[model samples]
Target: MFVHPAALCESDQIGPRTRVWAFAHVLPGAVVGADCNICDHAFVESRVRLGDRVTVKNNVALFNGLTVGDDVFLGPNAVFTNDYNPRASVKKTEDDLLPTVIRDGATIGANATIVCGVTIGENAFIGAGTVVIRDVPPGAMVVGNPARHIGWMCACGRRLDADLACACGTHHGADPTTGGIVADDA
Candidate 1:
Protein backbone atom coordinates (compact mmCIF):
# COMPACT_ATOMS: atom_id res chain seq x y z
CA MET A 1 0.00 0.00 0.00
CA PHE A 2 1.54 3.32 -1.09
CA VAL A 3 0.35 6.28 0.90
CA HIS A 4 1.47 9.82 0.05
CA PRO A 5 -0.83 12.54 1.32
CA ALA A 6 0.48 16.11 1.18
CA ALA A 7 3.98 14.81 0.27
CA LEU A 8 5.60 14.80 -3.13
CA CYS A 9 6.43 11.49 -4.77
CA GLU A 10 7.38 12.25 -8.31
CA SER A 11 9.66 9.26 -8.58
CA ASP A 12 8.21 6.18 -10.27
CA GLN A 13 10.92 3.94 -8.89
CA ILE A 14 9.73 3.50 -5.32
CA GLY A 15 9.34 -0.20 -4.74
CA PRO A 16 6.73 -2.29 -2.97
CA ARG A 17 6.32 -2.84 0.79
CA THR A 18 7.70 0.67 1.13
CA ARG A 19 5.56 3.15 3.03
CA VAL A 20 6.05 6.87 2.69
CA TRP A 21 4.40 8.16 5.83
CA ALA A 22 2.69 11.49 6.31
CA PHE A 23 4.80 14.66 6.25
CA ALA A 24 7.67 12.79 4.63
CA HIS A 25 8.71 14.05 1.24
CA VAL A 26 10.34 12.00 -1.49
CA LEU A 27 11.33 14.11 -4.45
CA PRO A 28 10.87 13.34 -8.13
CA GLY A 29 14.34 12.09 -8.94
CA ALA A 30 14.83 9.83 -5.91
CA VAL A 31 15.04 6.08 -6.40
CA VAL A 32 13.94 4.01 -3.41
CA GLY A 33 14.23 0.27 -3.47
CA ALA A 34 12.12 -2.47 -1.92
CA ASP A 35 10.88 -2.97 1.63
CA CYS A 36 11.97 0.48 2.80
CA ASN A 37 10.24 2.19 5.72
CA ILE A 38 10.26 5.93 5.35
CA CYS A 39 9.13 7.53 8.58
CA ASP A 40 7.51 10.86 9.29
CA HIS A 41 9.10 14.27 8.74
CA ALA A 42 11.98 12.79 6.78
CA PHE A 43 13.05 14.44 3.58
CA VAL A 44 14.61 12.52 0.71
CA GLU A 45 15.71 14.99 -1.89
CA SER A 46 16.41 14.43 -5.56
CA ARG A 47 19.24 12.09 -6.65
CA VAL A 48 19.10 10.08 -3.46
CA ARG A 49 18.98 6.30 -3.70
CA LEU A 50 17.85 4.04 -0.90
CA GLY A 51 18.61 0.39 -1.37
CA ASP A 52 16.65 -2.66 -0.31
CA ARG A 53 15.34 -3.17 3.24
CA VAL A 54 16.52 0.23 4.38
CA THR A 55 14.81 1.51 7.55
CA VAL A 56 14.81 5.26 7.83
CA LYS A 57 13.62 6.67 11.13
CA ASN A 58 11.90 9.97 11.80
CA ASN A 59 13.33 13.43 11.21
CA VAL A 60 16.18 12.19 9.05
CA ALA A 61 17.31 14.04 5.97
CA LEU A 62 19.06 12.31 3.07
CA PHE A 63 20.35 14.84 0.63
CA ASN A 64 21.50 14.53 -2.98
CA GLY A 65 24.52 12.45 -4.07
CA LEU A 66 24.06 10.04 -1.19
CA THR A 67 23.71 6.31 -1.67
CA VAL A 68 22.33 4.20 1.15
CA GLY A 69 22.80 0.54 0.38
CA ASP A 70 20.88 -2.57 1.39
CA ASP A 71 19.93 -3.32 4.99
CA VAL A 72 21.00 0.13 6.11
CA PHE A 73 19.45 1.35 9.36
CA LEU A 74 19.34 5.07 9.59
CA GLY A 75 18.48 5.97 13.18
CA PRO A 76 16.38 8.93 14.20
CA ASN A 77 17.84 12.27 13.19
CA ALA A 78 20.94 10.87 11.47
CA VAL A 79 21.94 13.13 8.61
CA PHE A 80 24.14 13.01 5.50
CA THR A 81 25.58 16.24 4.13
CA ASN A 82 26.81 16.41 0.55
CA ASP A 83 29.01 19.46 0.59
CA TYR A 84 32.41 20.06 2.15
CA ASN A 85 32.25 23.83 1.98
CA PRO A 86 29.61 26.30 0.96
CA ARG A 87 29.38 30.00 0.12
CA ALA A 88 26.11 31.88 -0.12
CA SER A 89 27.25 33.58 -3.31
CA VAL A 90 28.29 30.32 -4.96
CA LYS A 91 25.91 27.80 -6.46
CA LYS A 92 26.65 24.11 -6.42
CA THR A 93 25.81 21.54 -9.11
CA GLU A 94 25.42 17.78 -9.12
CA ASP A 95 29.18 17.51 -9.61
CA ASP A 96 29.69 19.74 -6.59
CA LEU A 97 27.76 17.21 -4.54
CA LEU A 98 30.47 15.07 -2.99
CA PRO A 99 29.79 11.38 -2.93
CA THR A 100 28.70 9.73 0.31
CA VAL A 101 28.00 6.05 0.52
CA ILE A 102 26.63 4.18 3.51
CA ARG A 103 27.62 0.64 2.79
CA ASP A 104 25.49 -2.46 3.14
CA GLY A 105 24.17 -3.46 6.56
CA ALA A 106 25.61 -0.38 8.26
CA THR A 107 23.85 1.02 11.34
CA ILE A 108 24.01 4.75 11.70
CA GLY A 109 23.15 5.58 15.31
CA ALA A 110 20.82 8.37 16.32
CA ASN A 111 21.93 11.95 15.73
CA ALA A 112 25.14 10.94 13.95
CA THR A 113 26.34 13.40 11.34
CA ILE A 114 28.29 12.07 8.37
CA VAL A 115 30.08 14.78 6.49
CA CYS A 116 30.47 14.95 2.74
CA GLY A 117 32.81 12.80 0.57
CA VAL A 118 33.27 9.92 2.99
CA THR A 119 32.45 6.28 2.56
CA ILE A 120 31.16 4.42 5.59
CA GLY A 121 32.31 0.87 5.11
CA GLU A 122 30.09 -2.19 5.20
CA ASN A 123 28.62 -3.42 8.50
CA ALA A 124 30.18 -0.47 10.34
CA PHE A 125 28.51 1.03 13.41
CA ILE A 126 28.37 4.70 14.18
CA GLY A 127 27.45 5.59 17.74
CA ALA A 128 24.89 8.17 18.77
CA GLY A 129 25.88 11.83 18.95
CA THR A 130 28.92 11.13 16.79
CA VAL A 131 30.18 13.60 14.22
CA VAL A 132 31.92 11.47 11.60
CA ILE A 133 34.59 13.38 9.69
CA ARG A 134 36.43 10.59 7.88
CA ASP A 135 36.13 7.19 6.25
CA VAL A 136 35.07 4.47 8.67
CA PRO A 137 36.61 1.10 7.95
CA PRO A 138 34.49 -2.01 7.50
CA GLY A 139 33.16 -3.64 10.68
CA ALA A 140 34.66 -0.90 12.87
CA MET A 141 32.85 0.76 15.80
CA VAL A 142 33.28 4.51 16.04
CA VAL A 143 32.08 7.02 18.62
CA GLY A 144 32.74 10.62 19.75
CA ASN A 145 32.78 14.12 18.29
CA PRO A 146 35.03 13.26 15.37
CA ALA A 147 34.43 9.53 15.39
CA ARG A 148 37.38 7.23 16.07
CA HIS A 149 37.70 3.48 15.95
CA ILE A 150 37.09 2.58 19.56
CA GLY A 151 36.54 -1.14 19.14
CA TRP A 152 34.72 -3.73 17.11
CA MET A 153 30.99 -4.42 17.09
CA CYS A 154 28.99 -7.53 16.50
CA ALA A 155 26.56 -7.54 13.64
CA CYS A 156 23.79 -7.62 16.25
CA GLY A 157 24.66 -4.06 17.28
CA ARG A 158 26.13 -5.13 20.61
CA ARG A 159 29.47 -3.72 21.80
CA LEU A 160 31.65 -6.79 21.98
CA ASP A 161 33.18 -8.03 25.19
CA ALA A 162 36.84 -8.98 25.92
CA ASP A 163 36.75 -11.82 23.41
CA LEU A 164 37.62 -9.08 20.89
CA ALA A 165 34.88 -10.20 18.60
CA CYS A 166 33.71 -7.25 16.62
CA ALA A 167 32.01 -7.08 13.25
CA CYS A 168 30.06 -10.33 13.33
CA GLY A 169 31.27 -12.63 16.07
CA THR A 170 29.13 -15.14 17.92
CA HIS A 171 28.39 -14.48 21.56
CA HIS A 172 27.08 -16.97 24.09
CA GLY A 173 24.10 -15.67 26.01
CA ALA A 174 23.02 -16.53 29.56
CA ASP A 175 20.97 -19.45 28.34
CA PRO A 176 24.14 -20.97 26.91
CA THR A 177 22.64 -20.39 23.49
CA THR A 178 24.88 -18.90 20.84
CA GLY A 179 23.91 -15.73 19.02
CA GLY A 180 25.53 -13.96 16.09
CA ILE A 181 25.12 -10.87 14.07
CA VAL A 182 23.92 -11.94 10.63
CA ALA A 183 23.95 -8.37 9.44
CA ASP A 184 24.37 -4.87 10.77
CA ASP A 185 21.59 -3.48 13.06
CA ALA A 186 20.77 -6.90 14.44
Candidate 2:
Protein backbone atom coordinates (compact mmCIF):
# COMPACT_ATOMS: atom_id res chain seq x y z
CA MET A 1 0.00 0.00 0.00
CA PHE A 2 1.17 3.52 -0.83
CA VAL A 3 0.29 6.01 1.85
CA HIS A 4 0.96 9.64 1.00
CA PRO A 5 3.22 11.61 3.27
CA ALA A 6 0.38 13.84 4.38
CA ALA A 7 -1.97 10.90 5.00
CA LEU A 8 -2.19 9.08 8.29
CA CYS A 9 -2.89 5.37 7.80
CA GLU A 10 -2.52 3.57 11.07
CA SER A 11 -3.89 0.30 9.78
CA ASP A 12 -1.48 -2.47 8.85
CA GLN A 13 -4.13 -4.39 6.94
CA ILE A 14 -4.30 -2.32 3.79
CA GLY A 15 -3.92 -4.55 0.75
CA PRO A 16 -1.35 -4.31 -2.02
CA ARG A 17 -1.46 -1.40 -4.49
CA THR A 18 -3.93 0.55 -2.35
CA ARG A 19 -3.20 4.26 -2.19
CA VAL A 20 -4.22 6.41 0.70
CA TRP A 21 -4.04 10.01 -0.47
CA ALA A 22 -3.18 13.22 1.29
CA PHE A 23 -5.07 14.28 4.43
CA ALA A 24 -6.84 10.91 4.64
CA HIS A 25 -6.82 9.15 7.96
CA VAL A 26 -7.34 5.37 8.13
CA LEU A 27 -7.37 4.29 11.71
CA PRO A 28 -6.15 0.97 13.09
CA GLY A 29 -8.29 -2.16 12.68
CA ALA A 30 -9.64 -0.99 9.31
CA VAL A 31 -9.25 -3.59 6.57
CA VAL A 32 -8.70 -2.03 3.16
CA GLY A 33 -8.47 -4.23 0.09
CA ALA A 34 -6.20 -4.20 -2.94
CA ASP A 35 -6.13 -1.44 -5.56
CA CYS A 36 -8.37 0.80 -3.44
CA ASN A 37 -8.06 4.55 -3.79
CA ILE A 38 -8.79 6.48 -0.64
CA CYS A 39 -8.75 10.13 -1.63
CA ASP A 40 -7.91 13.30 0.24
CA HIS A 41 -9.57 14.31 3.50
CA ALA A 42 -11.34 10.97 3.87
CA PHE A 43 -11.65 9.42 7.30
CA VAL A 44 -11.91 5.64 7.67
CA GLU A 45 -12.55 4.64 11.23
CA SER A 46 -11.57 1.36 12.81
CA ARG A 47 -13.73 -1.72 12.24
CA VAL A 48 -14.51 -0.71 8.66
CA ARG A 49 -14.02 -3.33 5.93
CA LEU A 50 -13.33 -2.25 2.36
CA GLY A 51 -13.15 -4.66 -0.54
CA ASP A 52 -10.85 -4.59 -3.54
CA ARG A 53 -10.83 -1.86 -6.20
CA VAL A 54 -12.93 0.49 -4.07
CA THR A 55 -12.77 4.22 -4.71
CA VAL A 56 -13.37 6.46 -1.75
CA LYS A 57 -13.37 10.07 -2.88
CA ASN A 58 -12.41 13.24 -1.06
CA ASN A 59 -14.15 14.46 2.08
CA VAL A 60 -15.87 11.11 2.65
CA ALA A 61 -16.22 9.75 6.16
CA LEU A 62 -16.68 5.98 6.59
CA PHE A 63 -17.55 5.14 10.16
CA ASN A 64 -17.54 1.79 11.93
CA GLY A 65 -19.92 -1.05 10.98
CA LEU A 66 -19.54 -0.28 7.27
CA THR A 67 -18.69 -3.12 4.92
CA VAL A 68 -17.96 -2.02 1.37
CA GLY A 69 -17.74 -4.65 -1.34
CA ASP A 70 -15.44 -4.80 -4.34
CA ASP A 71 -15.48 -2.09 -7.04
CA VAL A 72 -17.63 0.25 -4.94
CA PHE A 73 -17.42 3.96 -5.73
CA LEU A 74 -17.91 6.37 -2.89
CA GLY A 75 -18.19 9.87 -4.28
CA PRO A 76 -16.85 13.01 -2.72
CA ASN A 77 -18.38 14.16 0.57
CA ALA A 78 -20.37 10.95 1.02
CA VAL A 79 -21.32 10.35 4.65
CA PHE A 80 -22.01 7.02 6.37
CA THR A 81 -23.55 6.81 9.80
CA ASN A 82 -23.17 3.92 12.21
CA ASP A 83 -25.66 4.96 14.84
CA TYR A 84 -29.32 5.60 14.10
CA ASN A 85 -30.02 7.32 17.38
CA PRO A 86 -26.88 9.13 18.29
CA ARG A 87 -26.42 11.10 21.46
CA ALA A 88 -23.33 12.90 22.60
CA SER A 89 -23.86 11.81 26.18
CA VAL A 90 -24.34 8.15 25.30
CA LYS A 91 -21.31 6.05 24.52
CA LYS A 92 -22.34 3.02 22.51
CA THR A 93 -20.43 -0.18 21.97
CA GLU A 94 -19.91 -1.95 18.64
CA ASP A 95 -22.97 -4.09 19.16
CA ASP A 96 -25.11 -1.02 19.62
CA LEU A 97 -24.05 0.37 16.25
CA LEU A 98 -26.00 -0.79 13.25
CA PRO A 99 -24.10 -2.17 10.29
CA THR A 100 -24.34 -0.84 6.76
CA VAL A 101 -23.41 -2.90 3.72
CA ILE A 102 -22.51 -1.58 0.30
CA ARG A 103 -22.56 -4.45 -2.13
CA ASP A 104 -20.16 -4.96 -5.03
CA GLY A 105 -20.06 -2.44 -7.90
CA ALA A 106 -22.34 0.00 -6.08
CA THR A 107 -21.88 3.75 -6.59
CA ILE A 108 -22.72 6.21 -3.88
CA GLY A 109 -22.89 9.71 -5.31
CA ALA A 110 -21.44 12.88 -3.91
CA ASN A 111 -22.85 14.30 -0.67
CA ALA A 112 -25.16 11.31 -0.21
CA THR A 113 -25.99 10.42 3.37
CA ILE A 114 -26.47 6.71 3.96
CA VAL A 115 -28.30 6.00 7.15
CA CYS A 116 -27.19 3.11 9.28
CA GLY A 117 -28.43 -0.50 8.96
CA VAL A 118 -29.20 -0.33 5.25
CA THR A 119 -27.89 -2.81 2.69
CA ILE A 120 -27.16 -1.22 -0.66
CA GLY A 121 -27.39 -4.06 -3.14
CA GLU A 122 -24.97 -4.90 -5.94
CA ASN A 123 -24.50 -2.36 -8.73
CA ALA A 124 -26.92 0.10 -7.13
CA PHE A 125 -26.56 3.78 -7.99
CA ILE A 126 -27.37 6.47 -5.48
CA GLY A 127 -27.72 9.96 -6.90
CA ALA A 128 -25.92 12.98 -5.55
CA GLY A 129 -27.21 14.55 -2.34
CA THR A 130 -29.67 11.73 -1.77
CA VAL A 131 -30.53 10.54 1.72
CA VAL A 132 -30.85 6.78 1.95
CA ILE A 133 -33.01 5.63 4.83
CA ARG A 134 -33.61 2.00 3.78
CA ASP A 135 -32.24 -0.90 1.80
CA VAL A 136 -31.58 -0.37 -1.91
CA PRO A 137 -32.18 -3.19 -4.35
CA PRO A 138 -29.63 -4.46 -6.83
CA GLY A 139 -29.13 -2.52 -10.09
CA ALA A 140 -31.50 0.14 -8.82
CA MET A 141 -31.04 3.90 -9.26
CA VAL A 142 -32.23 6.01 -6.37
CA VAL A 143 -32.48 9.76 -5.74
CA GLY A 144 -34.01 12.39 -3.46
CA ASN A 145 -34.35 12.67 0.30
CA PRO A 146 -35.69 9.29 1.33
CA ALA A 147 -34.01 7.57 -1.62
CA ARG A 148 -36.82 6.63 -3.94
CA HIS A 149 -36.00 4.15 -6.67
CA ILE A 150 -36.17 6.22 -9.81
CA GLY A 151 -34.93 3.69 -12.31
CA TRP A 152 -32.60 0.80 -13.02
CA MET A 153 -28.87 1.03 -13.65
CA CYS A 154 -26.71 -1.26 -15.70
CA ALA A 155 -23.52 -2.66 -14.27
CA CYS A 156 -21.67 -0.50 -16.76
CA GLY A 157 -23.25 2.58 -15.13
CA ARG A 158 -25.80 3.35 -17.83
CA ARG A 159 -29.50 3.75 -17.25
CA LEU A 160 -31.41 0.74 -18.41
CA ASP A 161 -34.42 0.92 -20.68
CA ALA A 162 -37.99 -0.01 -19.81
CA ASP A 163 -37.33 -3.57 -20.92
CA LEU A 164 -34.25 -3.69 -18.73
CA ALA A 165 -31.91 -3.71 -21.69
CA CYS A 166 -28.71 -1.73 -21.94
CA ALA A 167 -26.78 -0.51 -24.94
CA CYS A 168 -23.83 -2.36 -23.54
CA GLY A 169 -25.52 -5.57 -24.58
CA THR A 170 -26.60 -6.59 -21.11
CA HIS A 171 -30.09 -7.80 -20.30
CA HIS A 172 -31.53 -7.62 -16.81
CA GLY A 173 -34.51 -9.26 -15.18
CA ALA A 174 -36.20 -9.00 -11.84
CA ASP A 175 -35.12 -11.27 -9.03
CA PRO A 176 -38.16 -12.59 -7.24
CA THR A 177 -36.40 -13.25 -3.99
CA THR A 178 -35.13 -9.71 -3.47
CA GLY A 179 -37.34 -7.77 -5.90
CA GLY A 180 -34.15 -6.49 -7.46
CA ILE A 181 -32.76 -6.43 -10.95
CA VAL A 182 -30.21 -9.01 -11.91
CA ALA A 183 -28.21 -9.58 -15.05
CA ASP A 184 -29.69 -12.41 -17.09
CA ASP A 185 -26.42 -14.30 -17.24
CA ALA A 186 -25.52 -13.62 -13.63
Candidate 3:
Protein backbone atom coordinates (compact mmCIF):
# COMPACT_ATOMS: atom_id res chain seq x y z
CA MET A 1 0.00 0.00 0.00
CA PHE A 2 1.31 3.38 -0.97
CA VAL A 3 0.11 5.87 1.60
CA HIS A 4 0.74 8.91 -0.53
CA PRO A 5 0.20 9.32 -4.21
CA ALA A 6 3.46 11.24 -4.26
CA ALA A 7 5.36 8.23 -2.94
CA LEU A 8 7.30 6.44 -5.66
CA CYS A 9 7.25 2.71 -5.10
CA GLU A 10 9.02 1.35 -8.16
CA SER A 11 9.66 -2.03 -6.59
CA ASP A 12 7.54 -4.92 -7.85
CA GLN A 13 9.23 -6.93 -5.10
CA ILE A 14 7.36 -5.23 -2.29
CA GLY A 15 5.31 -7.83 -0.44
CA PRO A 16 1.60 -7.69 0.30
CA ARG A 17 0.39 -5.40 3.09
CA THR A 18 3.54 -3.25 3.11
CA ARG A 19 3.01 0.51 3.44
CA VAL A 20 5.19 3.12 1.75
CA TRP A 21 4.47 6.52 3.23
CA ALA A 22 4.66 10.05 1.82
CA PHE A 23 7.62 10.97 -0.36
CA ALA A 24 9.19 7.54 0.14
CA HIS A 25 11.09 6.19 -2.84
CA VAL A 26 11.57 2.46 -3.05
CA LEU A 27 13.80 1.73 -5.99
CA PRO A 28 12.90 -1.00 -8.47
CA GLY A 29 15.35 -3.66 -7.28
CA ALA A 30 14.60 -3.20 -3.59
CA VAL A 31 12.77 -6.02 -1.85
CA VAL A 32 10.48 -5.07 1.00
CA GLY A 33 8.75 -7.88 2.87
CA ALA A 34 5.15 -8.26 3.99
CA ASP A 35 3.68 -5.93 6.61
CA CYS A 36 6.75 -3.67 6.54
CA ASN A 37 6.31 0.04 7.19
CA ILE A 38 8.44 2.47 5.21
CA CYS A 39 7.71 5.84 6.71
CA ASP A 40 7.68 9.31 5.11
CA HIS A 41 10.62 10.45 3.01
CA ALA A 42 12.46 7.15 3.39
CA PHE A 43 14.67 5.88 0.59
CA VAL A 44 15.24 2.22 -0.13
CA GLU A 45 17.99 1.76 -2.67
CA SER A 46 18.23 -0.96 -5.24
CA ARG A 47 19.11 -4.51 -4.07
CA VAL A 48 18.23 -3.71 -0.47
CA ARG A 49 16.27 -6.45 1.30
CA LEU A 50 13.91 -5.76 4.15
CA GLY A 51 12.44 -8.78 5.87
CA ASP A 52 8.87 -9.05 7.10
CA ARG A 53 7.49 -6.63 9.67
CA VAL A 54 10.45 -4.23 9.48
CA THR A 55 9.70 -0.67 10.64
CA VAL A 56 11.64 2.01 8.81
CA LYS A 57 10.76 5.41 10.18
CA ASN A 58 10.76 8.86 8.60
CA ASN A 59 13.68 10.10 6.52
CA VAL A 60 15.61 6.87 6.86
CA ALA A 61 17.96 6.15 3.95
CA LEU A 62 18.63 2.46 3.38
CA PHE A 63 21.32 2.22 0.77
CA ASN A 64 22.09 -0.74 -1.45
CA GLY A 65 23.95 -3.79 -0.09
CA LEU A 66 22.04 -3.79 3.18
CA THR A 67 19.87 -6.63 4.47
CA VAL A 68 17.49 -6.09 7.37
CA GLY A 69 16.08 -9.17 9.03
CA ASP A 70 12.53 -9.72 10.26
CA ASP A 71 10.90 -7.54 12.92
CA VAL A 72 13.69 -4.93 12.90
CA PHE A 73 12.87 -1.46 14.19
CA LEU A 74 14.70 1.36 12.47
CA GLY A 75 14.02 4.59 14.31
CA PRO A 76 13.51 7.88 12.50
CA ASN A 77 16.29 9.03 10.19
CA ALA A 78 18.48 6.00 10.73
CA VAL A 79 21.21 5.89 8.10
CA PHE A 80 22.86 2.91 6.45
CA THR A 81 25.87 3.53 4.26
CA ASN A 82 27.44 1.36 1.58
CA ASP A 83 30.81 2.93 0.90
CA TYR A 84 33.67 3.24 3.33
CA ASN A 85 35.61 5.82 1.34
CA PRO A 86 33.06 7.57 -0.81
CA ARG A 87 34.73 9.94 -3.22
CA ALA A 88 32.46 11.99 -5.44
CA SER A 89 34.90 11.81 -8.35
CA VAL A 90 35.55 8.08 -8.00
CA LYS A 91 32.71 6.09 -9.47
CA LYS A 92 32.36 2.77 -7.69
CA THR A 93 30.58 -0.33 -8.88
CA GLU A 94 28.21 -2.49 -6.84
CA ASP A 95 31.06 -4.91 -6.26
CA ASP A 96 33.05 -2.14 -4.58
CA LEU A 97 30.27 -1.45 -2.09
CA LEU A 98 30.19 -2.91 1.41
CA PRO A 99 27.21 -4.67 2.94
CA THR A 100 25.57 -4.22 6.32
CA VAL A 101 23.34 -6.71 8.06
CA ILE A 102 20.78 -5.98 10.72
CA ARG A 103 19.66 -9.17 12.39
CA ASP A 104 16.14 -10.08 13.45
CA GLY A 105 14.40 -8.15 16.25
CA ALA A 106 17.15 -5.53 16.38
CA THR A 107 16.24 -1.93 17.27
CA ILE A 108 18.29 0.94 15.90
CA GLY A 109 17.29 4.13 17.63
CA ALA A 110 16.59 7.48 15.96
CA ASN A 111 19.31 9.13 13.88
CA ALA A 112 21.80 6.30 14.31
CA THR A 113 24.48 6.15 11.64
CA ILE A 114 25.43 2.58 10.89
CA VAL A 115 28.65 2.26 8.96
CA CYS A 116 28.71 -0.36 6.26
CA GLY A 117 30.19 -3.89 6.60
CA VAL A 118 28.94 -4.35 10.16
CA THR A 119 26.54 -6.96 11.45
CA ILE A 120 24.09 -5.95 14.13
CA GLY A 121 23.15 -9.12 15.97
CA GLU A 122 19.64 -10.32 16.72
CA ASN A 123 17.65 -8.41 19.36
CA ALA A 124 20.43 -5.83 19.83
CA PHE A 125 19.30 -2.35 20.86
CA ILE A 126 21.25 0.66 19.58
CA GLY A 127 20.63 3.94 21.35
CA ALA A 128 19.56 7.13 19.60
CA GLY A 129 22.17 9.14 17.68
CA THR A 130 24.77 6.45 18.16
CA VAL A 131 27.28 5.78 15.43
CA VAL A 132 27.96 2.09 14.99
CA ILE A 133 31.41 1.35 13.57
CA ARG A 134 31.64 -2.37 14.36
CA ASP A 135 29.59 -5.51 14.89
CA VAL A 136 27.10 -5.57 17.71
CA PRO A 137 26.61 -8.82 19.57
CA PRO A 138 23.15 -10.37 19.87
CA GLY A 139 20.92 -9.01 22.65
CA ALA A 140 23.44 -6.27 23.43
CA MET A 141 22.25 -2.77 24.36
CA VAL A 142 24.70 -0.15 23.13
CA VAL A 143 24.71 3.61 23.57
CA GLY A 144 26.98 6.60 22.86
CA ASN A 145 29.18 7.45 19.93
CA PRO A 146 30.83 4.41 18.36
CA ALA A 147 28.29 2.31 20.34
CA ARG A 148 29.76 0.39 23.25
CA HIS A 149 27.77 -2.40 24.83
CA ILE A 150 26.19 -1.20 28.05
CA GLY A 151 24.09 -4.24 28.77
CA TRP A 152 22.02 -7.00 27.26
CA MET A 153 18.43 -6.90 25.99
CA CYS A 154 15.79 -9.56 25.83
CA ALA A 155 13.99 -10.49 22.66
CA CYS A 156 10.96 -8.83 24.21
CA GLY A 157 12.91 -5.51 24.20
CA ARG A 158 13.39 -5.39 27.92
CA ARG A 159 16.79 -4.96 29.59
CA LEU A 160 18.15 -8.11 31.12
CA ASP A 161 19.21 -8.20 34.75
CA ALA A 162 22.74 -8.98 35.87
CA ASP A 163 21.58 -12.53 36.32
CA LEU A 164 20.81 -12.59 32.59
CA ALA A 165 17.07 -12.92 33.21
CA CYS A 166 14.56 -10.48 31.81
CA ALA A 167 11.31 -9.43 33.40
CA CYS A 168 9.62 -10.85 30.35
CA GLY A 169 10.68 -14.28 31.67
CA THR A 170 13.30 -14.92 29.06
CA HIS A 171 16.83 -15.91 29.97
CA HIS A 172 19.79 -14.99 27.78
CA GLY A 173 23.48 -15.54 28.25
CA ALA A 174 26.63 -14.89 26.31
CA ASP A 175 27.94 -17.48 23.93
CA PRO A 176 31.65 -17.66 24.76
CA THR A 177 32.70 -18.99 21.41
CA THR A 178 30.75 -16.67 19.17
CA GLY A 179 30.42 -13.69 21.55
CA GLY A 180 26.77 -13.52 20.67
CA ILE A 181 23.85 -13.77 23.03
CA VAL A 182 21.97 -17.04 23.21
CA ALA A 183 18.85 -18.28 24.94
CA ASP A 184 19.62 -20.25 28.06
CA ASP A 185 17.01 -22.94 28.57
CA ALA A 186 19.04 -24.49 31.33
| lDDT of the candidates, in the order given | 0.82, 0.98, 0.92
What tens-digit string does per-residue lDDT give for candidate 2 at 50-109?
999999999999999999999999999999999999999999999999999999999999
Q: Per-candidate TM vs. native? A: 0.86, 0.99, 0.97
Ranking by lDDT: 2, 3, 1
For model 2, the local distance difference test gives: 0.98
User: What shift in Å separates residue 101 of candidate 3 from its native position after superposition?
Assistant: 0.4
Put down candidate 1 lDDT per residue, 85-123, tens digits, no spaces: 988899988898798999888999999999989888777
Model number with the top lDDT:
2
Instruction: Output the better candidate (1/2) by TM-score.
Output: 2
Off by over 4 Å in 1: 166-186
Ten-residue stretch with the least lDDT total in model 2: 175-184
The candidate with the higher TM-score, 1 or 3, is: 3
Clashing pairs in 1: 153-167
- Which segments of model 3 are wrong by more than 4 Å? none
